[model samples]
Target: MAEDRILVTGADGFIGSHLTETLVRQGAKVRAFCLYNSFGTRGHLDRLDPEVQAKIEFFTGDIRDSGSARAAVQGCDTVLHLAALIAIPYSYAAPESYVDTNVKGTLNLLSAAKELGVKKFVHTSTSEVYGTAQYVPIDEKHPLNAQSPYAATKVGADQMAIAFQRSFGLAVAVIRPFNTFGPRQSARAVLPTIITQIASGKNEIRLGNLKATRDFCYVKDTVAGFIAVMRSEQAVGEVTNIGSDFEVSIGDAADIIAELMGRKISIRVDEERLRPDASEVERLWAATDKAKALTDWRPQYAGREGFQRGLTETIAWFKDPRNLAGYDPSRYQV
Candidate 1:
């Protein structure tokens, strides 16, 4: 790790920012690939510890462009591809954009990695690719059933990543994580929506599909899983599930958050927040045995107790005035 030079795509976003900071702290030479913007903003990376920020080489470009992808991967020995358009609702309105960025962008990275002979190429995948769970704890062997355009594109990207390894002998791996919630998360996610509204002193929380279940992994655990996958030689050409084997329904999660906040609240079903009936994923729970076998990685936060502990920490962070300053809880975020 200390000898590795890593390139992290989507280094500007929630999980990406945390991963970048951790890599630098561990002494890896980190190059952060942030989406180019006119404002010169580095997303959450801009708020990282000054020392950590100083250590990262921030490159701004579009992942959809092959030229940009190659340039970013040119000198890096390893690449962690986390860049993608992730919002499900937005994906319905812009399915073509999802294909361009998630699928084509992934092909661009895979091609570059193969050409450069990267030692390890870890591509990020989401549990959404599984759609509604057919079994209690979904595993790597689970059949992919994408209900949304976002998930479909991810499935395409993931297969292309593995195909590179099979076809060109590149060292490629994919890590699929379940619902990940933490500080710095945007309101587009349900947990953030719940926490933000509560922090804003709202009693009536707006939500959708309360019956759906999720396996929520804390950000720190997910980051550790990514690092584990990166270091394991057994992970090449493999897809590992990184999640807690614990499930909580959306309705229950909101109630739990309210309990932790010591606030009694009611969930108001927001019509606009509901997904199309056929597009909704009714359940998700990950089986993480493969991750443990590969890298001895396990969620530090596990089960009901750990879930609550993670929520407590997240609540404390979002409750801070400085942290909550930019979040608008009044509006429904897609």
Candidate 2:
């Protein structure tokens, strides 16, 4: 059998860039679909090693454009759709953009993949769909509650992937990862927000809800889960959760980060940083049994060990002036 030819949308973003690098290292021919920008920027893809960058075929386009989406999918055996508006606070301010990018963009990819007879379509989803987690350890069968416009759009996109699988017999699999964090993550995310602030040598760390719990997965492990899902024949038309299955409250996580950095910092709750009462997701804990059963995927990094390892790497990156230049630790990132 020949190596799979893959198209990774949002290949310039945090998780997408890492996934793209891994796919290239694994000997898969990768076509990276980065958003078209006036400056010809490739987001975090520019941070990748020169050799890894050399191996990828960069395709600059927008997912919302049907022509771009179709062109990106053409002649690719597999399509991993990761493009979207992911920031919750930004989603609250601009819901129409989320619907356009997450919903409509996904529709375009599905249509193109189906039309071109792509062998596998891996749709990226988020644990945010299970808002607040009605029950502990959210399973694949758990109900989806869109607490924010971002989550709502993802829910719509995920259902559309399923619709294509059933309605058009398209080979599609959905991977819902919970709070993936590591290097190249934007400050909008809690982990990066905290890490950047700490690395800036701030005496007080400004943050929002400390009580909100999350199941954090290291980016590398999350990327491995995506590959496992792609390789598993049993994962087609299925939704799998990629997570560490370990929950950590925002407050506790901040403390851990401080310890890992060997810095003593005070946590100050910033009113401006808090989400709307109703929109805030109080808790999220993923159940990975289905993913393990279907894809034989188990997280290599779990619990405190994983959290420390991931945070250490993230802190080291942020401490460097070069990597730190892109972020503003003083401002509250939306």
Candidate 3:
């Protein structure tokens, strides 16, 4: 894949940043599509090593803009669409914004790719789209129930991406990953919220519902799945899950993290941190059989291994005074 042209939208975000770096390492000529901002921030892309930054072409624009999305997709062999508002709590506050960005934005990308003749489009999706899981191991055939606005918009966006593939013969595959976590994950996520707080010398971790369970995958593994999907012919026009089959409740995950960090912390249920009853995705576990059968991809890291790696890297980042500036430990992010 060396020297192949690729574009990764949401390149400045948690998963997007990791995927962007992975592509660059594989010798792809990468163009990172970052969201535009007046502050001129690149998000996690700015945190990349200086050598990696030099190799990338950065395009700042909204995915909702068809013209800009078209311009970015032109001449690219693969398009990895990852840009969207991802916070479930925030989605409740502004659903219209989510629709415009996630749904309409995907529409723009699909239209652009259809027009430009992009060979493969790897659309990023979240496991939250499955809601609280009607089955233990959720498969692509599993019914979707959007419990939150965030998941609802993703469902809409994902459907549109698939529609283009079926209607126009666009080579598109949806890569739906379960909870992906690592160093650059935002504070809004449960893992980061706990890690950042504990790393900052707090003896108590304030969290929302701890009974809810999730299937967590390290960012590296999730990014690798993206590459595997992009290269596999069977993956084209398919919706495949990239995740570990196992799951852990939020409370257990917190306990595990605390143990890894050697911190004896008490968990406090924060009212402001809780998701609305209707919006909460109480359980999310994935079945990766399709991905395994199609692309020969499997998760290498289990819960303990993934958690340890995440903790070590996250602790290192949070321990740095400069790196901790953006995160506000004093206030609840949600």
Candidate 4:
């Protein structure tokens, strides 16, 4: 696997950056596809060690553009498609962009991978596609309910991947992860929002939907799951879920972070932070039986101890002046 040429789309993003680094460390020749920007930024990839950065062949392009997507997929044996418009709030404001990027962008990759005959094509999906849990532990068989436009686009993307596999025999594997969080996550996410606020010396933590519960998996664990899915022959044409079965409410998660920071903080319900009631996902708990059965994969980080350790590492990163400077705590990112 190390000698295989791998292309990771969205290689500049939070999870994508970490996955790229992991692939490089394991001795794979990686081609990283980052969103083209005027400032020539590589997003979180710039934060990786200089030595790791040097090992990757970087390509700047938009996934929505067929020519760019085709160029990146041409020589690669494996393609991990992670690029998409991910923010739910932003999706409400701009649904067409989501369709173009998430739906059509995915179509671009699927078409390219099929034409190029990539050995493995991994498509990234989110638990948001499941919406609120209709049952205690959401599995691959759970009905997909797109409660938000962002989720709807993802649903379309996931189906497109499946369609490609059935119609064109594309070697596609879909991995749906539940609430992945850790260092490099932007403030738009709840974990980073709480950590950044507390690290910035805010006494009152502003949040929304405290009662909402989620199964939070550390970023490393989430990346590991991706690797597992990529390697397993059984994973081909299958949608596997990668998550810790443990669940925590938003209010309790905040309290845990405060405890780890060694500071007591007041919690405030900020109206702006709340999502539209209908758009909110009330609960998400994953059932990893299929992932375990198919790939011999199990989450290394689970429950309170894992959560605390991940939070500690995340808080440390956000506390650094260099890193903190990149974020504006005063403005609500979204």
Question: TM-score of every model?
Answer: 0.99, 0.98, 0.97, 0.99
Clashes of 1: 0
lDDT string for model 3 (75-99, tens) is: 8888999999998888889999999
Q: Which residue window of length 10 is worst by lDDT in model 3?
A: 302-311
Q: Candidate 2 on 155-273: residue-level lDDT in tens?
A: 99999999999999999999999999998999999998988888888879999999999999999999999999999889999999999969999999999999888889999999988
lDDT of 3: 0.89
How big is the positional error of residue 4 in model 2, measured in Å on the Cα after superposition?
2.2
Question: Ten residues in a row with the worst lDDT in model 4?
Answer: 302-311
The residue-by-residue lDDT of candidate 1 on 1-334, one tens digit each, is 8788899999999999999999999999999999999999999999999999999999999999999999999999999999999999999999999999999999999999889888999999999999998987899998999999999999999999989999999999899989999989999999999999999999999999999999999999999999999999999989999987799999999999999999999988998999999999999999998999999798999999989999999999999999999899988777
Clashes of each: 0, 0, 0, 0
**Candidate lDDT (C-alpha), each:** 0.94, 0.93, 0.89, 0.93
For candidate 4, the per-residue lDDT at 149 reads: 97
Error of 3 at 235 (Å): 0.4
- Over the stretch 20-57, how does candidate 4's per-residue lDDT look in tens digits? 99999999899999999999999999999999999999
Q: Residue 7 of candidate 4: its Cα lDDT?
A: 97
